[model samples]
Target: MPTEYSLPDTLDRIYTNQLALEAAIMELTLLIEQQGHTEVGENVRGALYAIGENAGHIKQGIAKLVLQHRGD
Candidate 1:
């Protein structure tokens, strides 16, 4: 029997989202660094934090892929 095809599309969507989030986080970091401590400083700091948390998740996903491919 043929396997379902939905999973690859879903994986691609997720990977794209992760890339977009990473790019947005990079931009936000730049903006915050340029603005320094000001009225928007707190908000920017929160964004930076959220980015770090998201990055941790991305790293885990990548690690799992590596392990799976390596047959570990």
Candidate 2:
């Protein structure tokens, strides 16, 4: 059977995935730097920053939801 998830659950999953992606991006960035690809490393780091920003947004949203639904 298919599984079901609530809003918070979904958001948590998204946040987790974002973190994983961020880690992977960092690792890839390091590898690029090790290869002396400064330009490519910079580009990858830029993307990593964006992903981190989005993850922060997701975390904030999750906190807001928790506060909004505190009584529940």
Best by TM-score: 2
Full-model lDDT for every candidate: 0.63, 0.80
Task: Please report the TM-score between candidate 2 and the true structure.
Answer: 0.78
The residue ranges of model 1 lying beyond 4 angstroms of the native Cα positions read 1-37
> lDDT by residue for model 1 over 1-44, one digit each (tens)?
22233444345467678668767866876786677745475676
lDDT of 2: 0.80
> How far does residue 2 in candidate 1 sit from its true spot (Å)?
27
Candidate 2's displacement at residue 2, Å, is 12
TM-score per candidate, chains pooled = 0.44, 0.78
Model 1: how far residue 58 lies from native, Å: 1.1
Cα error, residue 4 of model 2, in Å, equals 7.3
Per-residue C-alpha lDDT of model 2 across residues 1-72, encoded as one tens digit per residue: 122376766778878887887898889889989999999999988888888777767788898886765546
Candidate 1: clashing pairs of residues = none
lDDT of 1 at 43: 70
Candidate 1 TM-score to native = 0.44
